[model samples]
Target: MRIMLDIGHPKDVNVFKNVILSLQEMGHTVKIFVRAKESTKRMLDDAGFEYEVCPYYKSMAGKAFGILANDLRLYMIARKFKPDVFVSPGSPYSAHVSSLMRKPHLAFSDTEIAGLVTMLTLPFTDKIYTSTSFYLDLGPKQERFKGYYELAYLHPKYFKPNKSVLDKYGLEEGYILLRLSALSSHHDLHASGFDFETEDELRDYISSLEKYGRVIISSEKLDWDTIKEYQLDLDPDDLHDIINYASICLSEGATMASEAAVLGIPSIYVSNTERGYLNELETEYDLVYNIPDRGEALEKTISFLQNKNTKDEWQSKKVVMLNHNIDVCNFIIDRIINIDKRGL
Candidate 1:
């Protein structure tokens, strides 16, 4: 089988990397198409995977117009690859191009608030797979799975933390990991996180976290000199290893927050918006805390750091989560094989 996978974000690469390798091990040819984004291509290169970089527009207007432009580019690629199936994390380009090529497009999506992307992709996609905790219902084509995209790579069966990564970065255990999102995605246009009125205010807030332990800032946009000392400069592939050993994770990005939670690290997701998976992790599992307000989020972070037993409790909760959830990489591989056999 020839499988075509499209990566729309760096997180998409993590979600599908295991699946891609598993397909290839099973003697199937896997072709990857990725959008040009921060660290997306670099991570693929580090993983030693052959991929084609698709054109992406940074501006909002360009993104709107690039749909047709990208669709044409992918159409050309698919014409030559002639894949048996097209898969992505709900990409309209893949959906449209696969539909035009008369190939089935399988979308595994978790973001219910990406209204525009959902509208453009679902109508053309043959099947839509999402976590069981996903909020939206995409009619009959939607299928529920008992795991998250994070587990596809972060699951114990696939990933093990390497303490050497900590040494490489000169980081010690119990460091607080702070992740800042660019908040420039189409879905994040109205969302906000870490509401500091000024750069000095943000720097002061980060300095306060130093009392708990070392504060490592992994930011997408903020690069002012005030926070330069705290900013992390490491390979994208080493991030999960760092997350696995962190005392706590305070993140504006949903993907990193969920990743930390799955790794048994207590995560505080600070964003105006909500995700069904994050809600489940907080309510059902008590592994994650979703606090939209910046003040409340910081309060919770301080409380979590002060509590010495937090990591032990989170580890126990993580055991429960792992027992309940399926191995997402295996699940995806099985689904792909079955879908191909059934021609669905």
Candidate 2:
């Protein structure tokens, strides 16, 4: 079967890499259409995947216009490629294009609060897959999976830690991995993230972590003047390696926090946005601490770091979580093939 997969973010690329390979091995022709946003295209290049770049616009009006342009572009490309089905990580463009092409559209989303995209895409999508912990309803079109969207790629069967990455980066033991996202995405319009207004609070968080170990800051927007020496600089693919070996992970990004949790790393997630994925990781897995503000995040970080059995406890919880959840890649492949074969 011919398949068209849309790559909207680096996270989407990661989620579908193994799925694409498996599909190709099964003699399926797969065409990837990706957005040229951040390091998404770079990672696709590094992975040696053939893809066409879709332009991104920064301004609201530009983005709105770009959506129409991209929709038409995707429709034209899919018309030429003649794919049997279309898939993406909750992309409205894919939904629109597939609708025009009269092809089935399958979308996967873990975020319950992506209101704009959900409203625009779900009506056109043939099927919507979401985590069982997802807090929203999509009527009869929604299918619930026991595992997270991250498990599609990051499950232990597919990913192995590269300890050599530690030596290559000259990373010290017990370093805290810090990720600061741009928070400028459409869904993040009114979201609160990493209270940076009070520089003292930010400094205090770093200083407190410094006492336990080195603080490695990875910021998408601003560099911390005080921790300039510890800024992370490396290939985007090597990030998981560093994350696996880190003593702790703190991020304003939902994806990073969930990634850390699945890797059995203790994570302190700071954001006003509440995700069912993170909530399940926190309540059931006990691997992530989701705090609403910087003050509470600092307190939780200290508590997590101070616990001597943090790593062991989280790893044990990870084992239990893995035992209960299905291998997500197998599920994805099975469903895609089943749909294509049955013409469902």
Candidate 3:
């Protein structure tokens, strides 16, 4: 069978990398279409997958046009590739293009709060896979799975932490991972992330974290002219390895917060929008804290770090989470190979 997979973000690459490789190993041909997200193309290149570039525009004004243009380009590629199926991490372009091409479109998603993406993609998609804890109703097309999309890659069966990441980055002692995301995506239209009133506020925030140990900042938008020394410049794949060994993880990204939680690391997520996965991580697992502002975020960070048993507590919670979840990569591979079994 010939499969067409679309990667819209760096996280989508991680979500589907195992599935793409396993399908190829099983004598199936896979074609990848990727958007130029941060380090997305780089990761695909590193993994040795030859893919076609789908052009993307950065400005909000050109977004709708970009989506339409990409959809048309993808439609043209689908016609030439003659794929048996189409798959993505809930991309509207893939869903619309596959529907027009009369191919089965399987969308894997966990962001129930992304109403705009869901509304545009679901009607055209053949199947929508989501975690069992997902909050919103996705109608009859929804297929509930036991684990998150992140588990497809982060699970022990698929990923092993490379401790050499510490030696490679010269990170020997305790350190904190700070993530500042550019919350300017279509889904994040009204959302705010890690906002500060001034440069002084931002500098003060970073300074406060110094008491715990070293602060490594990973930003999607900030240009960090004053603190370039603290900015992280590692590969996306290596970042997870660093997350595994971090003293604490603080991010404006909901996805990274969950990634840190699943790896037995305590994460402080500062975002205006709440997600189902983060809620589960916080309430059920007690591994993540969702703070909407810098003041409360710093307060929680200090309280969390001050507790000497925080790591042990988070590790116990992670075991409970793992025991309840399925091997997501295995489930994904099986679904792709025997999609008819799901009555699609």
Candidate 4:
């Protein structure tokens, strides 16, 4: 089988990389199509993932024209790649173009179906895979829901990471990992406004945090001038391992917050928005806590660093989470082999 995977951003690239690899390992020829951001293309090249550039630019901030152009680009990629099936983690482009094509198209999504990309892509998806059935808003299409995103298609078993890369960044033992992410991509400016605020608050916050452990900042966007001014350090590989080994994991970003929790690190999520899978994990598992502002975030983070109750509880839950881990890749691969491509 031939598969084409479309991912629009660097974060999406990270999320979908394992799935693309898993699909290829399952004996399906996989070709990736994405809009490169910063070093995304180079990273994919280094990892030896085959991909092509999509023509659409990512700037319009969720505008109609942006989505339409992406749709056209998806069609172009579909024609160029001519894969038997098209898969996207959540690119809206697939929805518009795949609907017009004859082959099967599927999407693996965790965000709400009503979400802009999902909404646009819903009409085209032959199958939609999600972490939970909570995405029924897309209507009763053929769907598969799993217990966790890590299990959905990518798990540590399949993700080959080299943590020794941290030594290059001078990351030693006893460092606090701070992952910075903004809500701008989600079109929630209010929630991501924390991204634009002065580094004084972050510097002060880190100052308070460092008393508990050494502080290292892992920023998604590395502006050397500002990073140097803020005295932040960047180590791509160890940033994650550090999160896995940290005394604490702090982020305004949703993905890393959940990632920290999954890695068994106590996570402090600073976000104005209260809705998301992280909130669900916070309620169900004790590992994640939400703080509305930097001051409150700092307090909760300090308290968490001092206490191991949540980590202990999460450790207990982690064993069970693993036991319940459904190998979604197996299911997806099975479906692709047996699914009747005629209807969906």
Q: Tell me model 4's lDDT, rounded to 2 decimals.
A: 0.64
lDDT of 2 by residue, 169-261 (tens): 888657898888888777777777786866566787788878888889877765556445567677898988888888889999999999989
lDDT per model vs. reference: 0.90, 0.85, 0.85, 0.64
Q: Estimate each model's TM-score.
A: 0.98, 0.96, 0.97, 0.85
- All-Cα superposition RMSD per candidate: 1.1, 1.5, 1.3, 3.1
Ranking by lDDT: 1, 3, 2, 4
Clashes of each: 0, 0, 0, 0
User: Candidate 4: where is the Cα deviation over 4 Å?
Assistant: 55-58, 61-63, 133-136, 142-144, 152-154, 159-163, 193-196, 221-226, 229-238, 308-313, 341-343
**What tens-digit string does per-residue lDDT give for candidate 3 at 1-344?**
89989877888888888888888889999999988764899999988999988876676777778779899989988899999989888988899999888889998888877787788889999998888889988899988988787888988887898888898888964588888888867778888877865767778888999988889887786566634667867887797898899989999988889899999998989998988888887888888998888789888998888999988998899999999999999888887889877777
Residue range with the least summed lDDT across 10 consecutive positions in model 3: 221-230
* Candidate 2 whole-model C-alpha lDDT, 0 to 1: 0.85
Residue pairs with backbone overlap in model 3:
none
Backbone clashes in candidate 4 total 0
lDDT of 4 at 268: 78
Worst 10 residues of 2 by lDDT: 221-230
Question: What value does the lDDT take at residue 23 in candidate 4?
Answer: 71
Residue pairs with colliding backbones in model 4 are: none
